[model samples]
Target: MKATREAYGEALLDLGRLSDQVVALDADLSKSTKTSLFAKEFPERFFDVGIAEQNMIGIAAGLSLAGFVPFASTFAIFASGRAWEQIRNTVAYPSLNVKVCASHAGITVGEDGASHQSVEDIGLMSIIPNMTVLVPSDPIETKSIINWAFKYKGPVYVRLGRMGVPDLLPKDYSFDTKPYIFKKGKKIVIFATGIMLWKCLEAIELLKAYDIEPTLVNIPCLKPFPEKEIIEIVREHDMVFTAEEHSIIGGLGSMVASTLSRSYPMKVSFIGINDKFGTSGKPNDLLSFYGLDAAGIRDKLLDNIK
Candidate 1:
């Protein structure tokens, strides 16, 4: 198991070696966000902007204007909630090639509590017109998405987490705009993002005892949502569920619901934090407390099915 943030760090280093134009900026969180690896390897290319997320974004914008691909790092809450305006106006507005790779997203931020956790980052980034939002499930996908973000020339928000997740994708896995189908089943279909995809997979095992098999899909790209692909996938299933380690309000659940409501108009049960703030607790314990664990997800699915 490995934290996606670790993959981001490793990928950032690879990017530095692959491209000299690649630069990094952080709001005093290089060690946690794993940008330290990049900083260590390419100190000259990295700029630590202290604890000022807004200023860091501004510098990233300036770097972009100067023809550099700057990847700004910080906690998701600060990156999305604190420096939102700077990101919106400075980076996203001009369609600059700035990568805002915020780590420690969702309730999984753990013992740090709600103040640090960012359940609304996806929505915050998604609402922006020129921003692209991504949530990678595991380390492999995280690396793939990071590589993809470096190549894609625009404002990109890649939400990463501190919790270590199991390796789900293969070593040769590549990032595609379409959602990944982890399992094939009938009737019920589940769409999950980030670490929640791993939880959903666990929930599927519990469902097997009841002879309930649901198709599972991993949605890594939140913005530029795979509408065409989702429409095609939903047509094959009867029931739909969207799970995320975020608020049910503006994350994967909301996006899937909106898409289906307009295109196919189907019901999508949401499995996520019900607009509540996180509290200090062990990461795994917090997941269970919020009914985001395998058993909780299974029960929720069964409740809807019954």
Candidate 2:
């Protein structure tokens, strides 16, 4: 198992070696955000803004204007909260080649409590007009997404977690801006994002005991949501469910619901943290407490099915 943050750090190092124009900026959380790896390998190309997320974002925007691809790293809460205006006005509005790679996102930022946990980061980032939001499921996908972000011109937000998660994608798996079907079924469909995809896979195993066969989809791209594919998949299933380690309000659930509401609306259920703040605890325990774990997800689906 490997944390997505670790993959991001390694990807940044690879990107640095591939292109000198690739620069990294951090808000004094290099060690935690894992951008320190890039700083170590390419000290001249890295800038530590010293606890100033807003300034870091502005600097990244400037770098982008100067024809450089800048990657800014920070905690999800600070990147999407503290520097929102800078991100909106400086980077996103201009549609600059700036990548905001935020780590320790969602309720999985355990022990740090609500202040550090960013359940609404995806919502905040996705709301921007020119921003492309991405939440990779595992280490391999995280690397692939980072590579994609570098090649794609414009503003992008990549959400990553602190906890180590099991690898769900194959070693040679490449990422696209579309959703990927992990398991195919007919009774119901579950669209999950981030590490929740892993949980949904486990839930599927338990669901089989109850004679429920559900399709599972991994939504890595939250913004520019795979509308056509989602509509097609929803058409194949009787019911739909969206699971994420985020608030059900404006994360994957809300996006999927909005897409389906316009095209193929059905019995859509959400499995996520319902309008609440997280507390200090083990990551897995918090997931279980919020009914986002495998067993909890299975029970929730079964209840709705019956």
Candidate 3:
């Protein structure tokens, strides 16, 4: 098992070696965000904007304007919540090449409590114009997405987790803006993102006893959403469920529901944190408390499909 943030650190190192213009900025969170790896190697190119998330974003925007691809890092809460205006105006509005890679997102942030956990970051980033939002399910996908973000122009927000997750993708996997199918089944479809994909995989095993097989889809890209593909797949299914370690209000659940409501119009239910903030606890316990674990998901599926 490996955390996606670790892969992000490794990817940043690779980018540093590949390009001179690839600069990293952190809000005095180099170690936590793993930008320390890049700083250690390229001190001159790395900037630690001391406990100032907003200033880090503004500096990144300036770097982008100077023809440098700047990757800014910090906790999801501060990156999206604290520095929101700078990101929306300085980076996104101009369609600059700034990659805002926020770590420790969702309920899995653990022990840090409600104030640190950022279940709304995805929604915040997605709502902005010219911003691309991505949630990588595993370490491999995380690395691929980071590499892709560096190459793609404009503002991009890649949400990363703190907890370790089982590697689900192949070694040869490449990143793209499409949903990945992990299993094929009839009538029902379960769309999941981030660490929730692993939970859904676990739930699928429990569901097998009842012959309740659902087509499992991993949605790594949440913005500029895979709407056409989602509509096509939803049309083939009887029931739909979107799972995420985020709030049901404006995260993955909202995106999927909004898309289908306009095009396919299906009964879409969600398995995620409701209208509540995350509390301090073990990651697994927090997931269970929010009905985001394997068993909770299984129960939700069984209850909803009936």
Candidate 4:
């Protein structure tokens, strides 16, 4: 059964009651971002800043300046491309305590096609100076990390999805305000992010059939990237495989490969959407079409490595 993004709605609603300073803002996308519950519960704290993403960001920054921990929501495209200048100047430049929650990220936005998909959002946010990037693998992780961001005092851009995904991580799994390590192995490490984590998990199951147990690391916090841990793990492994639902150019796989090539010098098999923009289809159809599914990921990993 497919999970719903609405689970994030349940989680954020619970989080709002726990933090007095928690404020929610939307760029005409409260229902889409699953933040409508946050608005319904905390009417006074929630604000819909119209369709102007740049101005919405300004309002978030202003609210943060007034000591409020603001969580801004919008589709990934607008939040990154539309409000980039405002985000850079108002939130990141000042190192303000603002949280940006971008939903409908990656090609998973489906039938809406590439225009609605924000394939490079992760890369865009991760490169921002002093901006912390968090990409949760599933809805459960999404809630915990969003809650954790409240305690973190800096600008954060968290990527969420419009599509429902399997809960790959355990329900009790929590971010330690630090990177969390899941699978441990020596031959090869499969480091995955976002919805692709589940795909990697399936790949692991297939690899195990051949007795190949690759290490699987989940980097929920992509920025300040668990560099120390990643380096340590890569040193022990013979090769690496990085995967994500976004484009192969700038998403998780590219980030990992670039980091390893310079520092560790190990090979990384990247499994994700190639350079082509995504097309309109069912989410599952898109997954298979874009080679973002588990079986597709398994095929790629198997073909490249032993």
Question: Considering every candidate listed, which one attains the maximal lDDT?
Answer: 1
The C-alpha RMSD of each candidate to the native structure, in angstroms, is 0.7, 0.8, 0.8, 1.8
Question: Which pairs in model 3 have colliding backbones?
Answer: none
Q: In angstroms, how far off is 225's CA in candidate 4?
A: 1.3
Q: What are the runs in model 4 whose C-alpha is more than 4 Å off?
A: 1-5
**Tens digits of per-residue lDDT for model 2, 1-306:** 989999999999999999999999999999988999999999999999898999999999999899999999999999999999999998888798999999999988999999999999999999999999999999999999999999998999999999998889999989998889989987699999999999999999988888888999999999988999999888888889999999999999999989888887766899998999989999999999999999999999988988
Error of 3 at 91 (Å): 0.7
List TM-scores for all candidates, in order: 0.99, 0.99, 0.99, 0.94
Model 2 TM-score is 0.99
- Cα lDDT of candidate 4 equals 0.81
The whole-model lDDT of each prediction reads 0.95, 0.93, 0.93, 0.81
Off by over 4 Å in 2: none
Q: For candidate 1, lDDT tens digit of each residue in 1-306?
A: 999999999999999999999999999999999999999999999999898999999999999999999999999999999999999999888899999999999999999999999999999999999999999999999999999999999999999999999899888999986899989999999999999999999999999999999999999999999988998999999999999999999899998999998979989999999999888999999999999999999999999999
- Provide the clash count, candidate 3: 0
lDDT of 4 by residue, 1-306 (tens): 233346666767887888878888998889898889999989999999889889889999999999999989899888988888888888999899999988888888888987888888887887789998888888778878877888899999988888878776787887764545677776888888888777777778877776778888887877877777788878888878888877788777787877887788777788777777777888888888877787787777778875
Winner on lDDT between 3 and 4 is 3
Segments in model 3 whose C-alpha atoms lie over 4 Å from true places:
none
Q: How large an RMSD does model 2 have?
A: 0.8
Is candidate 3 or 4 superior in TM-score? Answer: 3
